[model samples]
Target: MAMTMRKMAVVAVMLVLAMAAQEASAAGGCNAGQLSVCAVAITSGSPPSAECCSNLRAQQGCLCQYAKDPNYGRYISSPYARQTVASCGIPVPKC
Candidate 1:
């Protein structure tokens, strides 16, 4: 019984570690809130700002993930957001 419990504990620890690693890698260098710079630009008709451009560039690798996110996917796919990205000279990620 003790051995079984030990094995279960080890499995639980491994599962936690694996989930952590996946979360880290899934972020692809962009953590939560990293794209907040683009919020105004995304939600309005105004042009993209310098900070927006910088953040967008920095988070390029995470664009696909962002597009797949339920909350952000809509904004990322909107025409205004696409225009903002284009005006910033950043191509819209195909994701």
Candidate 2:
């Protein structure tokens, strides 16, 4: 039973990693984790860091999908997020 559970856990982790890879790639070169850099600014009205801005610009192609996410959509579409993106000199794509 212990061995079976361990195998199941491994499989589950693999599945999750696979799904995450697919989701990130689906954005056409966007890595979702890069956007996490802006999470603090997005949620707390803080200034976006240089890194955050860089990620925002890099992840521009993923903006539309981010906007539509049920959990994270609000943060991505919030005024703060827009400001953060613009502060980085990145235009918020109209999607």
Candidate 3:
């Protein structure tokens, strides 16, 4: 009975952690429009708009994945994107 209780407790903790992670992921950040705008600005070498900057700031945590992706890394790593991000004064994620 004690062993069963311990196993159930462990399972409960794991479930809680999983739920927390999912909730965090679902939190507002980058939305479809923001990504499209960012992609356009990055590809065109145009400056990012205020809205784009706001979204980027909110979604900073997800940007590292863009940096890591082979398809997106090129554009995300470009001077224009870097300059726009710097101009926005949004801190880059360390991830």
Candidate 4:
């Protein structure tokens, strides 16, 4: 019983580590929450500010991932969002 418990603990630790690694690798290491700086620009069709552009560029690779999310997809996939990305000099992702 003790041996089984030890093995279970090890397995749990391994699973946690794997999840952490996956989360870190997702969205090209970007956390979409960081893109809040661009919210106004994306929603209002205004030119993005320097800080918004910086954050947008930083998360360039995550655009597709954000576009695939139900909660965020609409915003990321909107025409305004595309314009905002282009205004920032980043290519809008096809996704």
Question: What TM-score, computed on C-alpha atoms, does each candidate reach?
Answer: 0.66, 0.67, 0.55, 0.69
Q: Which model, 2 or 3, shows the larger TM-score?
A: 2
Worst lDDT run of 10 residues, candidate 3, spans: 12-21
Q: After superposition, which runs of candidate 4 have C-alpha atoms over 4 Å from their true positions?
A: 1-28
Question: Lowest-scoring 10 consecutive residues by lDDT in candidate 1?
Answer: 12-21
Tens digit of per-residue lDDT, candidate 2, span 47-93:
99988888788778888876786645666788887888888888887
What lDDT would candidate 4 get against the real structure?
A: 0.69
- Give the winner by lDDT: 1 or 3: 1
| Comparison by TM-score, 1 against 3, better one | 1
Greater-TM-score candidate between 1 and 4: 4
The pairs that clash in candidate 2 are none
Off by over 4 Å in 1: 1-28
Ordered by TM-score, highest first, the candidates read 4, 2, 1, 3
- Model 3 whole-model lDDT (C-alpha atoms): 0.58
Q: Give the alpha carbon lDDT tens digit for every residue of 1-95 in model 3.
A: 97686556435434433443354466654332344445445544567788878877876777776566554455556677687777679865554
Query: Which window of 10 residues has the lowest lDDT sum in candidate 4?
Result: 12-21
lDDT of 1: 0.65
User: What is residue 32's positional error in candidate 3, in angstroms?
Assistant: 7.3
lDDT of 1 at 11: 53
Q: Rank the candidates by lDDT, best first.
A: 2, 4, 1, 3
